[model samples]
Target: MFDQKDLDSIRESRQEWESETLEPFLEKGERKERFATVSNHEVDRLYTPEDVSNIDYDEDLGYPGEPPYTRGPYPTMYRGRTWTMRQFAGFGTAEETNERFHYLINEGQTGLSTAFDMPSLMGIDSDHPMSEGEVGKEGVAVDTLRDMEILFDGIDISKISTSFTINPSAAVIYAMYIALADQQGVPREEVRGTLQNDMLKEFIAQKEWVIPPEPSLDVVTDTVEFAVEETPKFHPISVSGYHIREAGSTAVQEAAFTLADGFAYVEDCLDRGLEIDEFAPLLSFFFNSHNSIFEEVAKFRAARRIYSRVMEEWYGAEADESKRLKFHTQTAGQSLTAQQPLNNIVRVTIQALAAVMGGSQSLHTNSYDEALALPSEEAVRVALRTQQIIADESGAADIVDPMGGSFTIEKLTNEMEAEIMAYIEEIKEMGDGSVRDGVLNGIPQGYFHREIQDASYEYQKRVDSGEEVVVGVNEYTIDEEADPDILKIDPETRNRQLERLKAVKDERDDAAVEEMLEELSEAIDNGENVMPYIIDAVKAYVTMGEIMEVFEDHHGAYQETASLA
Candidate 1:
């Protein structure tokens, strides 16, 4: 954007200032020598247009809402409508979580993102022995459809979009949601939400697999096909790189692995005779907004450009919406620190800003105290208000992709694009047609392990050498102490949740439940879509464990014995 004369003048002024003033001052050892961010490629100085000489404005970054959407997804962007503020809320029993959800909605939350406890996430009923100590410690305890009905008791599903953070048994949870919507007098086509049904990421990063790889992927593909026909407004899969980044992948690795997993899903759907345009429009993404502000922003921009090209050029997606990559972002949990807990608010704010600059459709900001426990009401409110303030007062929403034309940003965007493509080529050359195939064969897992090891080693080296400075950790050690009271789930809550599960089990018709389970199993064995039958089982008050048992008997459990090198 700058002319050659202007660039020369800037360089001349910078040299004069550095030589005459900066060097003399720094010679006294009075100022820090490190910059805030490090580039992926080895470089010692600031970037110039020379670094981004190959950028073509029309081809690399078209107008907002246009194809090859490197700028933003919508025409007016946030000026027309701000990104949805989705707070991930759940704790204790369904009733407790329902109260919290109502509180957030009343407090100006634009969307709801449910967080289920480990037992619910694992498809176990609260009454199970395995669920004893973990009924509602992490999130809400959902044992059956009755719990789901209670969870969204007074909420209107058709009015607000909901996102469920679950994997492994995502199909089962999705069925519960469908059943709940039916009870609320909402048609299947009117439901708008997302299911984290990306099973490949589960095996590759989160270690939350239920069935074997092939069968798990089969279930995911089935959901995609069913959603395309039944619930067109709902997203069947949210390919997530958040967990992969949390598991210690670099920013480039995060983008590459996530898009690779997405490509694998697209290939699977095509193999099932589904058109790319039909389902590609419904495909969405989830990513982590980490501490690297500008790099994370560039990562999102590059991801959109690369994904658009892949969809339009490789997959033959003709529609503009089908080629556009829509995504949601959550602040990085790994970036939060327990020490100097209040400082986490600033950390979350910066990360949320990065996500907004990158054109996120929806966002979930982490609370200051999240690293300590499930966030308190005070903490979550602040998190929600962070987005509200950014939207209403910061004036960032007035412009679309405001940082799109910067020399550094454009250069970083191109570098990130090339880095991601290199990884894709590597995965393809490994003899697997896609990353999912490579992951199913345990190749990506090994790659992830190696990358994590190297990153960790480098991080430790930096820390030990006193080159990396953490505010409250290594640099400024304080003898004074500050401990904030955190919210804790009551023990009685678990007891009450268990009692409710048992009461439902005792009151429901045993014979009818058996019949529904039998039908679901038969549907599974016959290779028929199991959503309808699963919904029937949910309505019958069949416990989560019972439904999972049926699937386990038919599909078998995944047993991973491959050791990473």
Candidate 2:
């Protein structure tokens, strides 16, 4: 970036100024003992050309839409079109959540992101004993195709892109959506959305699973293979770091572990005889944006660069889309506080800005009151307005890679790239050159859990010791007790869901449901792609529980082997 003579001159000048000016000023005023990010990367007082002297402009930070995509994925980025404003909303019965969907869309949201209830996510019906008191508590419940039909009753499927945040039972959800598309007269190729189907992360952090790792992963690969031929526009899998980060990982670990999980899926797909370029382009990612603006930005940038290199070099991907890492960003839920909950709006604003500057394809700004309960209508509208303000009022979106040339940002991106690549290398070595086997081997061994646990413990220790000041949690003490209006699930929500499920069961043809379920069971047993069979069962109104029961009988329930204390 600079000539040797010029660098030498600047180095001498910096030394003289630091000693004569900075040293005296620091001695009088004093400075903090240390400055570091959540990842424990030291922050220098100043950055110069020397900090990024080793970087190659074209090779490392190419123009937008080019290889290694460090600056941004597209040449115009937000200049061409703003990031999609997709809010995650779901609670109570399908009718209720559908109303919220209409509210968000009418409030200027461009996309839909669904959150399933515990019962739906666990692949059980609302009336199941295991689902007692849990139905419609956290997210929306959909037990059969009837619920899905009501969930999108009036919405035109071809017009809006939707994302489903569910795993383990993702294949079931996919079938329901495709069946809905069929009912709506929309061609499968035209329907678009994303499925958060990354199951490896389920074992590592989220702890939501029915079967063990291997078969859970096989079901995921089936969707990927099925999507390539069927739902061409839909993303079959979103390799996620959001849950991993929310479970307490440093930004580096979040990026590394998420990408490794993605690679494992890629390997599994390849082993299934799918071409690299065929399925890779449709694969997407999800990440969390915390309060560390610069660190989070650097993490996103480094991830893009690393993914591009590996896709092309390791997998021999021919298409640029296969190499580019396109991801959706959600503001950190862990950063939200129950006390002084309003402060989360400010936190979300900052995190959302970082995501835009870091080049996210889509963004979800969490409501300030999410720490207490599901967002009220008023709260959710305010959250949507935050994104509108950033896109229209703020000048941050006018340029591509607004922070591309910053010395500190570039330096941090380089360091982040190095650390993330090293972790992937270790995972690969663990499996003796197979990332799929490595992740599979690591899960039962608690390797990933320990890494995340250690980081989480260290961060908690810092907060407890006052080394890290969480504004509402550790510092700025306040004493007040007032109940703010929050969205509450009615005690009758579970009963309503069960009644609806029972009505659907009574109305649908029992013989058709049983025959479809038997066919689905055979598909699973024969090691065949179960997607078509699942779609058939969903269309037959086979309850999610009935379909999942076949799986439990065959695969058995998953029991955690990794011990953590």
Candidate 3:
């Protein structure tokens, strides 16, 4: 924090430099242009001391690892420990993905993030009629506990943490993970990872959902409660803004909406009589690191500041750990272009740098050729090396929050925070009580739809007007044929996976499977915590579809009614 006299002197010097040196150097007939960020917020050409004049250094931008951690959440940050290098991986059967996991680990990846295929994502077994050609297409397919066992066959669960990018059926997946850890002779407390158990974002952005909103929230809260008692190190809900951003929301909307969803989860847990500090610390966040360099950096900084203030002032979270907003960032997959495939390497490197500068706890760099298809072994290595270069070669991480207290960065951080709060108010005004309660009543969905449509329209306008240029997309028109060496899953893998699933089904006791499912259904009907029963069902080799069938019979599927008329 500079003193008043020092601030005045710096401002006077900057004014003289701009008037005498900068202005005269510009072309005489050049007209000033208003630059806007990816979020469509207007950005000024320059920021002076006047922009951050009201900022109290002690209260607003404290030292790293201190309260009001606008600087960073850690004391030494990357200097002490670099951000975790987690490559999001999955393809074909569990065995194939397991080999990929081992390969990445051998390549020096620090964490594991699993991606389930459509069938597994929808809580359907590989043998389901709905899962014909889609098995092992997009991501890996796990039908039962046996698949999970094979997925991490040789990997030590206790030595490495694994993140599951699943929702709607996150509880079931988590139950399988817990059961797997138990089978590995590791205590539940020793197992660590995150479950992207955010159902609200699923309805708002990604439409991969199963149960109705109320029941879904109940199941998610059940996981939260169970995590507090069983696996304290595991994050129950990774409230994700990544999908929302991919769905075309602006950067500010990404921050505010994601945090709003996080608050909704916290409120749900509190309503269930859980203590705020008990479950809030286990709550984590997932956000996007787009191509905007400075804007993305400011977005991450503002997210931490806003979450810290919200937890301390609004929720009265006592523990410092509870107030911390730890987040994982993935480079914008939607931003990748297939035109000039090699250019994507530069794109991902810059995005990965932004995430590191923004103080991410974990990061996943999109492979260069991802826009074409799943990455080849060579492409994934480049992605991993991108992070390694930043961590080792770049001096950006030498100091914690290197951009902290910068005139332009502070100004952008303040502006982004205000924009996010305005969006929150807009959602509240458009709905009944709070936006979360309104979401339960089906009001927030309409608001989200309209907002996304408008944002997309504005983005297209910029592209059409040639105001915003994507290098390979709208600018460089390349007519190259195609790259054929990309990774492709074999058709035989699907056949083998299906055959294995069927063999397991036949070997299991049919009577015990039915009995376990009946007990699971009874637990759901009796309003009992279904985690234990679901774990039991999975252990009995009950297929995912059969388990979901029991729940669907009791709770029914989700039906979204259009209330916009």
Candidate 4:
């Protein structure tokens, strides 16, 4: 956006300054080493307009809420309203987690993000033999619709937005949400929520798949189609990069791979004859905000720009909402450390700010002690307060794209865009120009796995060599023992959950549950939308394990053959 004469003048001045000021100072050897970023990119002493001379204001960065949304997605951005503070909270039994949810809502959290326990996430009931010690160890143990009902006991479905962080049993979890909504007398169309129904990422990173990859995709596509027609206000799938990043992908891979998965979903939906505009608007993203402020901001900006172009140019999307990229961001859980765990509060603050500056629609700041255990009540409150201070006191929400037009940020953003586009091109080529084929086949072929492995290997090498410094990890050493009060899973949590499950089973109509399950099975076999059927089954008090067994019987189970070497 700089004039040619002005750019040239600035470039000459920069060169002169570098030779006279920078070079002379370096010759003194006052500084022993060159500066490098967390990504191991060498940092320039200074950035000038010359670095962004090729950028076109109109095309690369028009106004916010416009094409190629490099600036920000919304025109007024946070000035319109601050981003949602959606602190992810779930632990122990449904009653226990429900209390935590109530505490967060009372603590000014704007949205509900549920974290399911391992058993529930794996499509296993609390009483399953395989689920013995893991009932509510990681998150809330949701065995049946009765647990779901207790999970939202006093919560108003129509007034709040709920986001579930479950993958393998997404259909079952979605069924519970819908059934709960129905019982609450809330219209299907009025329900607002997001399901992390992204199965591709599960195969590529998280390893949380229930059915095989191909059939898993069918389930995801079915949810998208059903949401388009039934629950228009709800986001059927939150195509996520958080787990990918947690699994050790670089920032570029996080964006490229996650968006590639989103494209795969689009491909499936389009193949099912659903219009791009119809379901694309409901497509939302989940990204990770690591400690690198500029990199995180650049990554977020690049994601919006690339998604808009892909939607409009590649998918024939017309509506603005269909093309606009909206996302939720969680502070990097991998960045937290156990040693001097209080240091994590500062790390979380920085990461949370990066997410805010990057224009996330919602944010979840990880609890400082999360590296130790499920967040204690005090730790989670501090995490929520981190976002509150950023929004209310920091004055960061007064403008749109606060980092836009800065010389370094613009350069990094341009670099991020180009790199992510290249990755997308590579993924498409791997799939024979179809993102669907590339991701589906690439999973078994270890394409995504190998890339992330290589990136992580290089990153760890940097850390081990002291080229990259983590504050409390390699740089700082505290000899004193940390005595932080940490949250521990209660020993009785599993028993409580199992007892509740037994009660629900005993009280429910067994005949009606069987009938509804049969209907669901028929719909799954007949290629009919199973959402309505699933809703009916959950309402009949079908346990998650039972429903998942039906899916396994029909769709078969998957064992990923990809090697992680």
Q: Pick the candidate with the highest TM-score.
A: 2
lDDT by residue (tens digit), candidate 3, 89-169: 999999999999999999999899999999888888887798888899889998889999999999999999999999988
| Candidate with the greatest lDDT versus the true structure | 2
Clashes of each: 0, 0, 0, 0
After superposition on all C-alphas, the RMSD of every candidate to the true structure, in Å, is 2.8, 1.1, 2.1, 1.3
Error of 4 at 311 (Å): 0.5
**lDDT of the candidates, in the order given:** 0.85, 0.93, 0.87, 0.89
Provide the TM-score for each candidate, comma-separated. Answer: 0.93, 0.99, 0.96, 0.98
- Residue 163's lDDT in candidate 1: 93
Candidate 4 lDDT tens digits, 402-501: 9999999999888889989898888888889898998888898888889888878898998888778877788877785765888888899988888888
Tens-digit lDDT string for candidate 2 (1-565) = 7779988998999999999989988977645678888666678888988888888899999999999999999999999999999999999999999999998888888999999999889888898999998999899998999999999989999999999999988999999999999999999999999999999999999999999999999999999999999998999999999999999999999999999999999999999999999999999999999999999999999999999999998888999999999999999999888888888899999999999999999999999998898888888888888999999999899999999889999999999999999999999999999988999998988889999999999999988999888897899969858747999999999988889888988999999988998898899889999999999999989998999888899999999885773
- In model 3, the runs with Cα more than 4 Å from the true position are 1-32, 428-435, 441-445, 561-565
Q: How much is 391 displaced in model 3, in angstroms?
A: 0.2
Which stretch of 10 consecutive residues in model 3 shows the poorest summed lDDT? 438-447
- In model 4, state the lDDT of residue 162: 98
Cα lDDT, model 2, residue 311: 90
